[model samples]
Target: MMKIEGTLYPWRFRLVLALLALMVAAIAIRIVDLHVFDHDFLQGQGDARSVRHISIHAHRGLITDRNGEPLAVSTPVTTLWGNPKELQGARAQWAALAKALNQDPKVLTERLEQQAGREFTYLARGLTPEEGQAVLDLKIPGVYGLEEFRRFYPAGEVTAHVIGFTDIDDRGREGVELAFDEWLAGVPGRRQVLKDRRGRLIKDVQVVQNAKAGKALALSIDLRLQYLAHRELRNAITEFGAKAGSLVLLDVKTGEILAMVNQPTYNPNNKRNLEPAAMRNRALIDVFEPGSTMKPLSMSAALETGRWKPEDRVEVAPGTLRIGRYTIRDVSRTEGGVLDLTGILIKSSNVGMSKVAFDIGGESIYSMMQRLGIGQDTGLGFPGERVGNLPNHREWHKAETATLSYGYGLSTTAVQLAHAYATLANDGRSVPLVMTRQDNVPEGAQVISEKVAKTIQGMLQQVVEAPGGVFRAKVPGYHVAGKSGTARKTSVGSKGYKEKSYRSLFAGFGPSSNPRIAMAVVIDEPTNGAYYGGLVSAPVFGKVMAGALRLMNVAPDNLPPPEETKAAVAGESSKPGKGDRT
Candidate 1:
């Protein structure tokens, strides 16, 4: 049998034949897999070598004011990205890219070196169309520009604080941008394309997802009102030589913020040189001891508690009252002995209000303030809103209660004070202060009886109409009621008030017959010979309110006679708080 097999085939030949058959079978199997069974896998492997990934950016949403005016928007832009691993003449390429990107070559070289093995590195963000094209013309390998968007603030500094700004990645960084980031940011998209050896796209492999642009947002602000407020605020700041200033106009019925302005505001378009003080939205963020502006709250508390009436009398001995070891005195040193509740408000007597607060007791007074929305957020949705410092009743010292009565011990933001006044103007029902419109009017929680509110309103009106009171804020044809607040700024190391620095505030609501607008204006450290709220801040309030009322188309209740309307002489005392005198 061995002899017969040897004769039939040579050993080497048999071995070669066996190896050839095995090789042929392996080839057939591989062909089948590549052609049919596992074609998708093999195709993916081929694409892996030749395909390039590119990102498609989705457009960011638009920001419009209440009247559909564009405050901020997204405009087409380009971003340059590169594959450092594929870059040739790394130094020259980097230098060219840096020149185009307006960046330092040395910094770019370092970035490229760090990302040597990386497939992608951002060379520059938010390039203009011309700049993007210049880079594209360089024809550098591994470098490409993608279409994107950059935020544009059309109203510039006027709408800066309200609209805010975005980061490089089109994400909100501050203000409304930060508050509504999710709604403002849109979904991104991606594409895979086959590229030739030269990195030119040859074919599309797949489209993973389609990009969706962000939805548009409408705000409650009016651009015209915003501009008016800004211009007036700047002029006031400059004229008074004040340290800073803020003004806010509110819709009395709905509580929608019509205009909010803070001086030392920054241009959102050029934020590189912005100062911290300029960026602060003082309306909602800064808190101060409200001084006599808070007396109305104290008096209302006293009246609501049935311990006192608008006609109740208090003895203002020496124009001062001593509580615990502390003594409270009126701003005016001319002493008066007996005063009614209305007289206390009209005179803005700290001595009288302290007695009233004592009559109301600490708990009821604090509870009333809490219900009036003081020491709380106004639900305005603004960033960094401070629920201004209000000490617990249990923690209150006798001095704290007495001083707080006349707005000394506690601190509050301008917005909170405005909201409190708005509550009073709204007939003792507290509506949620809003920045956006709602379909259904929010039901207000009753803070005081309508009777108490009416009495307080009448007394406050007297504060404006009375000759001795500080409210020379009356416009010729309209009824106005408000209080002037003057508080010596608290110093860090000083035991008492700062020598020359004081916070002056004027807060009021208009057209007493039918209140429509509620506003607050504050001037910090006015240096041009006047420091009282009535002297420095109220006139600005009058001008702004006059403009706002005209814009609102409210019929004038009391137009001045032609003689009264004549421009006052340069040095005449036109009115107590008129700008001419200030």
Candidate 2:
């Protein structure tokens, strides 16, 4: 029985060895099949878990003032992101991660739960590198930090409306930022990287696309003048308790905007709770009736028609003129309302202007306003600029034309008004307004005859330098020319005008003998009981223009008799005489 059992065991052992050998051979064949025939498919599956293409945010452009002072710039930051799929199994560490992120664990967990099927989600954005590093220090699975850029404004709210602000993605949203967004926004890039099972970056595989930084932008703004204007305008706004305001200053020779500021501004750096009203660039985007401020220019139109002379007298008797049902009054009546053209301007007499408008007809006034860039595109390249209204009547009547005389029928913007005054400053030559610094100023068009423009400019000086004029706009030691306006604001939906609400305004240029700078100021709804342009807006213009003239070292044409003699003596003494030229 023992011999038989041993023989059976040997047979059984042979059969088991054959079965084991066959199994090893089948496994080897399958291994070769996977290694060669199905290699690409299997490799792709492995790569899907560990490889990623991440977006590389672009570095936005730098914005600077004409003097190379930094205004808008980009600073390096880090963004923390997570893979919801990878984070599914990372719940145990979510509390530690939430603590590092300064977020509630429950909130973080719930967010992850909601996006459990997603591959990526932002944990935090625009954090400092150090702050993001702290969150990464926890070594939590599925969490990562990425480099990014955040837009920063050095001037902050002081330069808010002009420079505008960028969105979180470093994209421009308004003002020059939006106007030249394509020039300022750089192209984004992509990168291929390898990560571990826990979503930790193992290595940078390759650059899918290299990021190109945006170009630098140099604006026409003079930072010194900008600060000065901002300070004065802000003080006036706060003093008068005004709702909003704008101040625009331009180079008379170049049509370059030197300093433009608006009140009720916001810090571009801090973008929370932003008010839409505060962001409007009132100088260009907002329009008003312009009120009596248009009198000087409109009178220029009357002169251009050759129907009225600077000394021509209009019988504005009874201190008012009745045109149809509208009764235009000279609230500032003098000598029973009989005034020459110059007197009309100095007194800002609506009755006189209405008579002039009636006599000259609306055709000439509308044509002149259009040439002044009113009711037409300023071509300033500003975003959201509204072309103010000027109706083109098929038949011009005395009553209809009267509206243009007092700045009631048409509307204009601060920028447009400044441009018109600048045209006078430039001897009737009008150039397109520009935001960027210019090496070669564009050729100006002769919108009005130089003689007529000079005559109007001379008369306007009396509106500021003459006795009983708008004296608040006077800059001592400098001859100034300006016009003031206090217009009743048109109610919402164009439902007539509001009796209590007034828009104060002033448009002028300094060194009237040879004007170099032109400015326009507008104060909306001054509530401290002083709503007139002479009281509220002229002071800002005077202060800002004085500082600007000094900053630019413009020669004063209105120095005292003694100072002028002294300056002349100094100039003669400094001269090298005839031999110096050779």
Candidate 3:
């Protein structure tokens, strides 16, 4: 057997053992220091790389009509974001991520390049839950999504002018949304969380601040009435081939706007194609000469001076009058021989109106206008609401005064006209117009004597009830009172007025005796050869009024139904011809 013998040195063996012991002691010391003395510091350094603070979104308030119908609401959404620096490192995943985001890869690369130093960038904001989840499923590095709220408008263009819409972050942008943004948008919250290297949330670390939900707002608008107004106004604008139109319906007793709608409105839900013109609330913002509708107010001013009575007479034989170089002419060339106050309204005699207003003087006219809330804040607090233009009485020339009597040299919004007519309908009491439902009736300021208001109301009723009246505005089973106006659009750059362009308007209320609602309809630049308010605007008023009265269950004031009038017409034919009578 071969035996192996080792010639080993005792000193070398002892040196190896000594080195092993030193290494073991050093390792033991390091373990104790790391576990006991520097544990918190080291742990904090590790967490700093993976832990992040995040925002918790809070939803905006809801906007509903008086009957609790939602006009505007918010829906849960997500915002996809990413660290551009980290995302740039994952070039191989860029094409897939771009496809997921529905963006071009080149565009994504350029965007990241543009934000080279940015640690964070938005890939997409206000994405739906499904869209965001589709992106998250890819699990690309540095890509992440956070909860958010996106505004949604259900009423679209129908209530766009009233309810408005919000921004990407759910901030109110227009209409009632902007008007009451603070009341609608609430505060956001914060949270701390642990995130994996791929930007996925692993666990919630701490809640920094709890979010407070926004309060809901209830408007005075009746969605049903609003829808009706929208449909009718849109139909009118299209039918007349008009540039734009507005309609306002008010509760005369309450001074609350039941419905306000404008044509040429845009869909608030999709704002990418928004135009500045479509965004305008024309009912509150646009103004024009009110034409013959002003005659009632002028007549009221004349009566206030005790210079005129409901039975008063004025000669309008010529149908044309000269106030300086301006030749004031009536719509009809045929002379209205003589007209009492009621006759003047029924005939819509511009000659008679000029005579009455000039006789009343400018101060009385201005006072009546001020009292009627013309050229004044509507108390709606709406953004971009114009007070319109009413020249100070002190600035009135003879020509201007004559023009003012017939609704020229002055401008007013549709809402202003509606409010003024509402005052007359409510027995000469003027109250602040409201857009929100009110629990208590607002105090009313008297603008005219109830006797005078009643008299004017009778005259207006005559305009619809008399043979040569605004028959187009008459409503069946209801005593309707209204005024029609056709004003030429003033030329933009210079000179007199546009030849054929006209603003057709109608303003009134019903049932005339116990007025429940007052409304105004204005159609701009009607081009379908029906430019007169009696022809273009009055029909809309009648249709809307008839439908609204029925919807509100208002008692019918007329003895016979309008449909019964067809039988009356048939009976007339059966009675006799001129030859048979002879």
Candidate 4:
């Protein structure tokens, strides 16, 4: 068999040749596919192995108050980055980076060593120019820096709540910043970079996307007025040892917020130390029982319905009135024996006012309040505005009706009270309160008859100028009409009012004969002996109103001297049965 195999068959030899040919063709086909079919893909793979990329930041926009005063802005800074693969000795490089960045060497080492294969890592952010120069001088192979921007607030704490603050990435976090983030944060740009053999950026290939700077935002807040209100409120908080306070000034005709200040305001610059209470904008966010200040609304409703006259007499027995389990007592403790509608307002009598509210009925009183914008937001565009709490007429019990009549068992924001009082000054028209100026003035709804509004206005004047009334708030030369409110603050943990803690409030319009500005001042827990609104809050109202009135150049209603007006009031009072209007 071996001897025969020596002379091989022709067919077997042909098969061996065919197998060899197939192997050669397979190798040739692989070579052609690699060189021709995947030419672009191979080229791209090679380029990718040699090049690296990084991101760049764009500049943010400016924030200004209504008067073009800078409130929030951004400044250029440098962010230090490092490439771990390029760092030969991690420990040594981290020490050098720590010294340059003023950070812990251990922390830098951990950050650099944790991601050893990464091409990029942020070492420090928001470095000053000098610090960035120091890092650049080191000429470390792995270390690099990029120019970026960080937020800055020029007005600091003064405009903190209005202008708000931004985050580490220069993005708005609150207030106007959060409200207009899209318009304030500019579009980011992109750059293409080329890397060398050592995995370091050799040059910028090109700018892939051009950055568009953010649009400047102009707010409705007036910086000067903001500063003034801030200073005054801070002073009130300090001088009176008040727990907190707020002052709001409004343009009666335009409904623009001239000034709004809340005490204990925080500085957005040092936001890490901010407290929950300091961040609250009390004027817009807080609501409370308005106390005697709401009495005017009740009386106004009664007069509007033709159910009562200013001179009509109502018997107010003793100083207290028992309704259900609650007893309402007068602050002065004087028995308001026989008081007219005007006398009830002057004395702030709970019994007499309750009579008037009972006559108007719950439905009419609630309807009138709704029309006057009570229990509603004032449309001031402030974030977190409270509409206040007012129970429906059907929900009111016997005691609820009488207590609500004298401004209790209901809550209202300071702005709402000012807006409602403004309606009384604006000839019974309740215009929408606005924070910004509009191209066209918004027409208001008629909440009361003009005659009824005038009667209430006349009665409110007596609340400020009558003999037994708390009228020390009246300015010497200005005809002021407003009501005082001294309400015990409700405790958070208890149903009873806080001891020795009161919220003193005053809402008034200056030059009452032709009102221009309507203002409200609320002092929380004033420690000074004077806890009455007419005594504590009214003085602040007078001061702010005097400045605002003079700023507007409004003519004084009492052109005569201060002494002459007192003499006139005294002379008029000497005549029996002769009533004096404020």
TM-score of each: 0.87, 0.88, 0.87, 0.84
What does candidate 3's lDDT look like per residue over 425-463, in tens digits?
A: 999999899999877888798889998888889989999
Model 1 lDDT tens row, 410-524: 8888888888888888888888888764456668888899888878888888888887875558776788888888888988786778889999898888877777888888889
- For candidate 4, lDDT tens digit of each residue in 437-503? 4456568777789888877877777788788766667777788888888988898987978888899
Question: In candidate 1, which residue ranges exceed 4 Å CA deviation?
Answer: 1-34, 90-117, 196-200, 204-208, 333-336, 395-397, 493-497, 560-582
Every candidate's CA RMSD: 5.6, 8.5, 9.0, 6.6
Judged by lDDT, which candidate is best?
A: 2
Candidate 2 achieves a global lDDT of: 0.89
lDDT of 2 by residue, 15-41 (tens): 888999999999998888889897887
Task: Mark the regions of model 3 whose C-alpha exceeds 4 Å error after superposition.
Answer: 1-52, 194-202, 333-336, 561-582
The weakest ten consecutive residues by lDDT in model 2 span: 1-10
Q: Is candidate 2 or candidate 4 better by lDDT?
A: 2
Better of 2 and 4 by TM-score: 2
Name the better of 3 and 4 by TM-score.
3
Tell me the TM-score of model 2.
0.88
- Per TM-score, what order, best first? 2, 3, 1, 4
Q: List the global CA lDDT of all models.
A: 0.82, 0.89, 0.88, 0.79
